[model samples]
Target: MQSKATTPTEYIHELPDDRKEVITKLRDTILSNLPEGFEETMNYGMLGYVVPHSKYPDGYHCDPKLPLPFINIASQKNHIGFYHMGIYSDPNLLEWFTTEYPKYVSGKLDMGKSCIRFKNMKKIPFELLGELASKMTAEQWIERYESVVKK
Candidate 1:
């Protein structure tokens, strides 16, 4: 999997037709609410956004080029996954998501290590998801991701 994100627009252009529509809407929500230092790119064969090097030379845990805290919108054989770094990186955020998601959604939204999987985009709460995306700095996010994954 590649580690760098090319450009937000280009990333969307690369998605397959069925995935493109959902991911583009998801991408737009994220871009609209991005924190100061975030950037968009293509990594792991998916569209991703990260905290750029300018904000922190060593992004999110001192790994400058690592894709530690990113959102990966993927089109899998069975479903789509809206991977939010915040889900792995923040206890508070994760708790909130689990609690509130069901209240707002009527369909399936599966999760695993920050990856929010949904077979249909109709199930996602795009605005709430976007707000969560804008919540933390890459460094803080890395701390959360590492805390969970490193164990």
Candidate 2:
């Protein structure tokens, strides 16, 4: 769900009481596992981690005025959305996730190219999420993103 909250703290504060604990845990996991150069903030009404313009001056190809996005977390209408940009653009990464996720998950895995939606918090695989989040630094992500854009 698009949130009106402008800050991560505000976002957490406004989350539904029932959903608060899980989201907090997920947020903490993301922060703890996040790569060194990605800054966390609110973007597109979601919790966004981006490679700031100072790091990649070209900014996002889609929107040059904005920083390059690496990942996002959102509370949608009925589920939580976890996005991993690396998996979306790299076939190898996507394959790795598809191959490995089943070992940790038993419930239905509803996922898109970059988005994994979870209705039940218990269904989330924190270990996998942490691994994915920490796999690359902002510089590496920028190189990967640029390489794909060139292709």
Q: How accurate is candidate 1 locally (lDDT)?
A: 0.70
Which prediction has the highest TM-score against the true structure? 2
lDDT by residue (41-142, candidate 2, tens digit) is: 887898899999888899888778888888899888889899888899888888888888899999667999899999887788988888888888888898
Identify the candidate with maximal lDDT: 2
RMSD of each: 3.5, 1.3
For each candidate, the alpha-carbon lDDT, in order, equals 0.70, 0.87
Which digits, one per residue and each the tens of the lDDT, describe model 1 over residues 37-94? 6677765667777755665455545454664456777666677777876777567878
Q: Distance (Å) between predicted and true CA of 134, model 1?
A: 2.2
Give model 1's TM-score versus the native structure. 0.77
